[model samples]
Target: MSVPKLLIFILLIFGSSTAFAQHEEEKFDAAGTILHHILDTHDWHITDIPTGTDAEGHATYTPIALHLPWFFYSSRDGFTFASGTESLLEKGYVPYHEGLYPLKAGVSVAEHMDDHGHLEIHMEEEAFKEAYVDEAVTVIDLSLTKTSLQMILIGLLLLFVFRGVAKAYQRREGQAPKGFQGAMEVVIIFIRDEVARPYLGDKAMVFLPYLLTLFFFIWFANLFGLMPFNSNIAGNISVTSALAVLTFIIIQVNGTKDYWRHIFNTPGVPWWLKFGIPIMPIVEVIGIFTKPFALAVRLFANITAGHFMVLGLVSLIFIMSNAGENVAGGLGIMPISVLFSLVIFALEMIVAIVQPFIFTLLTAVFVGMAMESHDDHH
Candidate 1:
């Protein structure tokens, strides 16, 4: 064959093989499948059971199960159980559960219990009391849960980094900052001069700790979420909601007497107008609550939406290839998908920094509004 023909043949073979491989991988690449595996299964530590019998010996040697950081098992049809034999027959393989009972090739007979097992039963009950109370539902998986761990880790990291910086400064005792200390000093000053001073003025120092911590903590969490193995804790609604509530509380607690009086009882308004102005106060109160709600939703939605979009784009390749005839079409779309992924990745970097800034800025604005004094110059 000529060089051109050989090249064409090679391309055809490579393309055909890649298509087949991708088709197989696509089964596990569905929207939530990869995420579920990562969140639930990846680095999952499973304890092994002993296979061999002990000294008195029904079976002299039992199979010993060891804990593994990673293991793969299909949950498609669900797990199984067996009687006496320690063999589990699933997908034509005899797999051991907990390294002991060989799961029989069938549906699991074991009843699923909630994390707490407060409501333990085989079947659902109609009566209120009999109904599975699902204690597990309320019992949060603190270790497995993303938000708690993220917050704890972020807080610790901030303290460590800040502490280190402080120590470095103390050692230098006024000399120019070096290395990490210098970098952090620059960032701290920038935030103080650019972010805090401009917004909060001299009183900005009062909120400096909170503002700095909030900015860096959020920025770190956002960046962490973008890491391959890290969880999207800030993207979680509950976490964002808590942060929003904190901001709301601060705004309310720090509100000046003038602020409250203006909302509850407008000073200059005529008596008849003030008495009739029931709707304004209601709207004003609603607005107060809505501000924090918007803050929470904005941060949560933006972070979550970015992840979903990236996942969706990657999923498109699988969906199209699974359609069979669209091999060429899918191949054609790969570059576009990759391009968009790169773009989004870059955008995410900006968002990582920008989101915390926006959050802090809005927080300061809200605080300023609440503490605004008529006596002070505009």
Candidate 2:
């Protein structure tokens, strides 16, 4: 079939599934539905299905979700564990939104909230301690969330693919590359020659492994996020932050004396700027941190915005449907929604490839700059 037809077919299948789930509720919460898909959670929600009806005759849905393990720690309970959120909830834990909280007897989670909608304690200091005297049983959530699980899957994929490719190389020592090996070789060479060598120069080989790993990991993670019924791994700020931190550490550790001097005692700048007020030094110091901060935010924002575009477009159909009241309106909007979602998905595919290259390139550039000598400036 044609590309347009294929997109329409896929969108129809996807949209209908989600719409059916949303229709189970009296009011379709577009924001909640969208957020639930985007955010990290303890459970992997595949889809929802109509199970039966409530006593009041309202529709009920049984979410086909994968319940992941929950790990929590608190001073009172020490290290505690549960099979999943359901088990914890059954054991006196309150399920509020995406998190679980332990409430004192007769004290509902809603009763403790302040005006701003956040959970806050307004009682006196002594009373506050008395209320939670069981040693702050608000367990610290260290569980492996959806994002972390997706990352682990990506790691396994990389390990398996590369291990196979490595065996192929051993078998065919000098033969002409073919099949998957050839495709993998093309990317590996591109990063080594085009990306790493230019910036890292003589040290390219030293950093080649790191650069290649960064590229493949980010690229794979991005592609995984685009898949249907998968978690948005790269879009999670925590993941990006960890990647950025790695780059930051490498750059700082490899920084030469000249790099440090350039920041604290800039050579070319006027003495007044360097020593009198120390403005330049402060700005330079801030730049050290801001570089990685920008890297993290850029990747996170681009990936997340791409998801929002696709999901938002798909959401239009259900929003226009008005809980199935305006069927004709929803049908009329389907074509437009599918077309836009297709375009965004295509653009996102390109972004998935390009963002990884950009990140690797910038990381190399930062490392190279840090290794620059005082003579290079002259």
| Top candidate (lDDT) | 2
lDDT by residue (222-306, candidate 1, tens digit) is 8988876566766777777888999899889889887887777666656555568576677578889999998898787677656
Error in Å for residue 327 of model 2 = 0.8
Cα RMSD of all models vs. native, in order, equals 13.6, 7.9
Model 2, global lDDT = 0.80
Q: Tell me how many residue pairs clash in candidate 2.
A: 0
TM-score of each: 0.65, 0.82
In model 2, the Cα lDDT at residue 8 comes to 46
| Model 2 steric clash pairs | none
Local distance difference test values of all predictions, in order: 0.62, 0.80
Using TM-score as the measure, which candidate wins? Answer: 2
How well does candidate 2 score on lDDT at residue 274? 87
Model 2 C-alpha lDDT per residue in residues 207-320, reported as the tens digit of each score: 999999999999999998999888998888888999999999999999999999989998888999988989999999999999999899888877877787788788788778
